[model samples]
Target: MSTDTALQVHSLKQSVDALSEKVDRNHSDLLAAVGKKKKNKDEGDENEERGNWGSKIDFFLSCLGYAVGLGNVWRFPYLCYRNGGGAFFIPYTIMLGLVGIPIFFLELSLGQFTSSGPATCWKFAQLFRGIGLGMVIVSSLVAVYYNMIIGWAFYYLFASFTSKLPWSECGDWSSAYCLDRLPLMENCTMRNWTATVNGTCLNGNGTLMALYNETLSKETMGIKRKLPSEEYLNNVVLGSGFSDGIGDLGPVRWQLVLCLLLAWIFVAATLSKGVKSSGKVVYVTATFPYIVLIILLIRGVLLDGYQKGIEFYITPNLDRLYDARVWKDAAVQIFFSLSASWGGLIALSSYNKFHNDAFRDALLVSLGNCLTSLFAGFVIFSYLGFLSTDLNMPIEDVAEKGPTLTFVVYPFAVTKMPISPLWAILFFIMLVTLGVDSEFVLVETVTTSIMDMFPQTRKYKTFTVVTCCAVFFLLGLTLTTNGGLYMLDLMDTYAGGWNVLVISVCECIAISLVYGVRRFLNDIECMIGRKVCGFIPWVIIKYWWAACWVFITPFAVTCVMVFSWYDYTRLDGYPLWADALGWLMTFVVILGIFIPAIIYLCITPGTCGQKLRILTNPLVEWGPALVKHRRLVARYVPNYVVDPWGKEDQNGIAPSDIAVEMQKQDAPGYTPSPEYYAQKM
Candidate 1:
């Protein structure tokens, strides 16, 4: 090489090295802090720990991705329409402040305070280890069918690649009454309606109808035929009627089965390398969907009937505030949208450093979830408003919830837009990514639980992730059968619904009442480097937060749960037996709270009162996973302590502390034993 070329190369190398040195100098303390508790992979290593996020942004986005998922985009919009549009915000916001954020902050405290998964965080209340188990169980149950929802999005995504959207027209999968009248209805007036005779209806003139129903005014318009989209969903996609009930799942739909397999593979591939990879994967999974949401919002607002849709979505009817059911729905939406009572919250926080400011992090995530849901409502309702105008139907008739709103209403609306295929692909891809982000954490929650229980599995993460994917995939197969939607609806209603409320109620009671809210707050202050008592006037974060946990949350959640059960009705299609089975399934998860208590009580050597005392006390084996973590905790909040077991740590204890016993020896970075180890503590 010539001397000039060599000199240029040498100059570039020197410049790069100089820049690197500057960065190292600027971030020296940050680098030192991060490297202190780096992941350890060694034989019989007690200091073995999971890797944390590469940076704070990773954790924030990961939490955002997990909390604001499919429900935020689809379910929240429909619930707003059904509950009271603008009026729904009152109860929703009220619940958010009173019940939602408190529980959110509580879980963050419990997990970060100990650096443990949900199952292992229950040392504070040994009798309620079942609460942790219940969280994992509910998450596992929801994860099965949740993936099936993604599979449906995949099917539509592939179907959208056609020259024309397949659900655009009616054929063999349509009902006899189904009719396409977009052009024909263009010239028709409000007086023009579907006519009824003795035989059938062809373009609103029906012969098979028993009578003329249009004599009375209906909020509905152009009801002479089923929309091609609705027919495709009911007839081609779900094929719901063949099965007797949840009991008869019917034959599997091969297309959906394949899609389900693909869904599991998608999730497994995302989680195969654990958080080391997933922390980076979320960069796309979490943030890119906002781009699609923005595009849809802009396109929707510019449509022909945008004003009407926004009106139906945001206009308030104050009368709804009087209904108890509206309040119940508000609570349910908060629970569903924020992903509270799910094990994912604890599992996600368990990866944080000892002194991470989780208080600020929790506020960011919870409020971000609410804001996303609110904005998504605008995007959805705008499209529905357009559909209403185009079809000459009322806004109410165009809005729906759950799968129908997502897979049916939205997909059909996309087909009507310009460059329909492009919009369809982007919309479905957003749906898949949003759902997959949450599923990633859910799959990890299960893996984290099992790994925490059996530390050796950490070395075989790939095998464990694949095995989890396979097991959940096989379990999800029932939901891909001809009657899959019906089974999904049933599982959601039973295995998924009230069980969440039960878990939330049980957790609040255990944490606030049994574990002691003040003590919990102390632990949190230790981590966040600030007291809960803040300078927000009548609203100190710690004082109000503690009040909610101790009084407001438990009371309010109990009332809602009671109100939910007061006049519960069974699903329409299923027989009486199915309702019984649904309740039975719900009870099974709640039963987890008792199972551990029963076994522990039976095994412990103590009197009845002694057992009660021991059951309520903190376990002796609980403390920081490493001396370094403990020191960090002490350094930030010097007055705070981690003496849960009350064992001496250059200090003394008085009470008969609760004794926690687990079969597995592994914790965050230390193994527990019957006798406390001073050096480890």
Candidate 2:
């Protein structure tokens, strides 16, 4: 061949070689993708095979931890005191038995059986997962404000060291000192020239003059006069707001900021490792509250007026029970207090192992929570009785609202006790721990759901959750200021109080009626590898949950609405914006349930061909007709099963088949017979 021909042939050979190399690389890339997919599948299968498996003790502890929070210690007792002293318990117990316990078991069972979070568990039931999502959202909202309260506890813990008696000190200097305004004290104390003062102190010539030779002398003389009458000074302190007593330089704001930071740091650290860390934390977090309760109870009862407090707590008048409204209030209290039927428990329970005995666990947790609430009431009332006696006030006067109980009344009690600083420190520390743990878990539940829904954004989910928490903290800060009390009341009553109860009842109804209660019960029995007792079915399905949802939810909502409307119309300073926000939140929660269910039902028919469709996908549109379709599909399909990509696999083997297999395995007469095999063949 010629030289030119040889050169062309050489170039051709090189081109072929490069093409071959490219093909090989592409082939390797495809194999790698396949291998990665398989590896993920293997890991997931191993995780699943490890099965709905958790240490029973750990599971129990976690459930207990989630159920019992600062509410049990700080909120419940005061609620009891305000509602009707000991009379509250009659309705409280009735509510727990009828509503709380049933809803608790329902959420626990749904979670463990589905082996999914709140969002997924509802989807598993082929119901509106929005309701579950609403619970998650509500929890997240709550966690934000809740953490802020924990931050306050943290602030108190830090302030305990610097102040002589952080809770008891009285003076204008006291307020300034609590707020860390030492440098600004002189400026703040300067008389306002703009004020119209008409007093002899203004001076004989009507020219303003210093009350004493210098500011320091005036301060010293004031202190001297107050020192001899410390009791009188304390009375004055009690009458005035802390801001009026303490100098602006007090460490209160710094403490609050420090608390917020510390809370964030602790929550971030605890959750950084995910469930493993949270689970371990729960062991202490759940139990420590009880320990504190025991200590407080022992000390509280030993006080001089302990019997009076106890009488106030337990003096149930049958007349209170005669009013249906009182019973309704009790029911609402129980629902809020136990947090049953709330998506929070449902989401948390979803993390439980498939074979976990959630039925029994739910009962224990619910009962334990209620018992703690009752115990806490006794501890609180006993202390209040002591305070009443010491202050020469009525028990009714000493017994105040929730915030007053925690921030004022309880502090007053501590100050009167021996070695109060130590007890105060311990009490606040316990509150911080209890509150933070619950708050962190709530944020994590929402974060986990977000991560599950958008795996591609997993890297950013934690940051997103932290940011969400931070925003909530800021909002809570606004609520922490002197005038924030009214706003807090509005939020608590409309957003946190009545709204939560209503949403919970709706959730239970959605699960019961839409999902079919019988199916859920069966799912629970199979998942736990045992038969649920007959009582659960009869009580949960037939009467308890149904009655509460029908009666209690409506009544509470009406009361709240009436109160809100009256406030909006009559109260001069009522915040219309807050009212609007409250209604908006309520609407979001109410409509949230139906939205996802509708979407899932709508696309389910076409979803079979487009198997990538998922219920959690934000792109999905929800409508009533779609929900109907989902229900129809779920009747024949096992809606709970998920494909490798975490999408619900509706074509998987029917749940009924699995139920049958489980029954056979568990049946007494399930032994294989040679004659049976011959007949089958």
Best by TM-score: 1
**Total backbone clashes of candidate 1, pairs 3 or more residues apart or in separate chains:** 10
CA lDDT, candidate 1, residue 419: 85
lDDT of 1 by residue, 1-681 (tens): 999999999997876676556445435643343334332221122233665656667778888999989999878888789888899999999999888888887887677667688888887668888888888888888899899999988988898898898888777767655545322232222345444332222345532332133212122433354578877877677666466666677888888998899999988988898876888999999998899999999999999999999999999988999999999988988888888988888888887766677777788899999999999999988889898898776776678888888877787887788888888999999999999999998888899888888878888989999999899999998888877887788778887677788888888888888877776776676566554223323225678877888889988988998988895887997878878877877887888767988998898788988988888887654545655455555654435454543333443321111122333432222233423333322
**Every model's Cα RMSD, please?**
13.0, 14.9
Clashing pairs in 1: 198-207, 199-207, 199-208, 200-206, 200-207, 200-208, 201-206, 532-542, 617-658, 618-658
Model 1 spans > 4 angstroms off: 1-48, 181-224, 241-248, 531-540, 631-681
Q: Judge candidate 2 at residue 273 and give its lDDT.
A: 50
TM-score for model 1?
Answer: 0.82
List the candidates' TM-scores in order.
0.82, 0.68
Residues 302-387, model 2: lDDT tens digits: 89988888788778666666666566567666666766645667666656655556767877888888887888888888998887
Candidate 2, superposed: residue stretches over 4 Å from native: 1-54, 124-127, 173-254, 457-467, 474-477, 480-482, 532-573, 594-681
> lDDT of all the models against the reference?
0.77, 0.59
Model 2 CA lDDT for position 658: 28
